[model samples]
Target: MSRDTRAVVEELLRRIAEGDHERTAELFAEQLDWRLDWPADGHPAVPWIRPRSSRADVADHFRSLSAHHVPELNGTSVARILVDGADAVVLGEIVQTVRANGAAYTSPFALHLTVEEGLIIRYHIYEDSLTVARALSA
Candidate 1:
């Protein structure tokens, strides 16, 4: 990855850590496209934030998460970023605590993200799938 791509990835991680939602989305171009492979055994079909080529998609995505009131996740830590030109990878951990259905639980996870052109184009996420499933079911 070029240094520029690495810089972009670093900036993205910083923005996310700050929970700057608008700024996080702004980094992606209007013609951007993103893909994510999240563990699906437990969580609902709520969309995780991603870059899309359409502004409408961006609005819809953010609205969906907000409407669901997916509590702001905690313990998000981007460990490192590796850039390979237009493609880059980020290794990190994410922790979320959800209180719904009169129950509560937490999900801790590790992940690898692949980005392109300053936009996340793909994600190969791996984590404790069962733990996440149980938390979401709570």
Candidate 2:
């Protein structure tokens, strides 16, 4: 029996909210589509705002994110989660304080995940990249 898309997405969110980034990566497929709403060049100051490929990269992404942000000051407020078949869309706002500059930024974001056979095959995120970039600037 395969898990539904909503269940997989919910589990992913649960693991992330618990700050278990390594476990969160386990929800993704070994080799899958990954995208962040940043430029191809990526933000010079934000290390985690780059591209990811495999599940290992996914783990690195979360680890880098945790390392760069002030854990106590990081938060997310999900507006809604819409699931249709194998697709799930999560709408929310992310608030984070940059560890380097101590600047906080809040960006409304939409994350689209495609789960198949209990594993996430597609990860796409759209957010205000400039706001995140500014927060990382000195």
Candidate 3:
């Protein structure tokens, strides 16, 4: 039986929320194409927000996030999900506390995902970069 694309996405989000990095990586293709809609040079300011091309890189992205921010996973919520065939758009908010200065980084996020053969092939995320930068740099 083929898995529902929506279900696959929801499960991946669940794993992320639970801080199950290993399981989250499992849901991604071997050569995952992950990107944050931000300038590559901004990586110096926000290490987690960078382009990644492999599952290990994806895990490194989250590890960078974990090192820098304390995410309020309970406050994260998906406001909407729109699916078309293998493509999905998720609109949501992520609440986090910058570990450096204890500033809150509550920002809206729009995520685009493409699933193939039950694995996520593309993960493109757009978020409030300015807000996040200010909060983290504070």
Candidate 4:
């Protein structure tokens, strides 16, 4: 049997938690529609803060994330997940230390994903941009 939408999303999250960005990118469709609900003004200073289209963009986003922050894998937490049909919503928290200033950035996040044929076609992320920006600027 083919993987269901929830399974596909769960696997994607698993790969991300494992810091397997390449594998995560592989889970995305060739023409992905990815959006992080952060201010566009921040993009000039932060590469990962911009919009992403396609798997290569996703990989670049992860690369920028790694370049800017050191994530606390032990502190990462997942609060909840809701999956229906081809869509899934995940609520979680990420703890990261900013590479520039050594400040900690702890933010709760909500991710909305749409999966088709076991590949993620759409990804929308909601998080506290101000907290992240402050950490980066500190």
Greater TM-score among 1 and 3 belongs to: 3
How should the candidates be ordered by lDDT, best one leading? 2, 3, 4, 1
Which tens-of-lDDT digit does each residue in 1-138 have in candidate 1? 587777777786676556566776666666544443243222463344333445345445545544433456454566666666677666666565543542333344443445565665544455555554565565
C-alpha lDDT score of every prediction, in listed order? 0.54, 0.88, 0.81, 0.81
For model 4, name the residue pairs that clash.
none
Give the alpha carbon lDDT tens digit for every residue of 41-138 in model 3: 55467878777888887777776777787665336789998898898999999888888888876889999999998989999998889888778777
Candidate 3 segments exceeding 4 Å error: 1-3, 72-74
In Å, residue 133's CA in model 1 sits off its true spot by 3.7
| Candidate 4 lDDT (Cα, 0 to 1) | 0.81
Q: Positional deviation of 113 in candidate 1, in angstroms?
A: 5.7
Best by lDDT: 2
Worst 10 residues of 2 by lDDT: 1-10
TM-score of candidate 3 on Cα atoms, chains taken together: 0.90
Instruction: For model 3, state the Cα shift of residue 38 in Å.
Output: 1.4
Give the residue spans of candidate 1 off by over 4 A: 37-73, 101-130
**Pairwise TM-score winner, candidates 2 and 4:** 2
Better of 1 and 4 by lDDT: 4
lDDT, candidate 2, at 51:
81
lDDT of residue 8 for candidate 4: 91
CA error at residue 15 for candidate 1, angstroms? 1.3
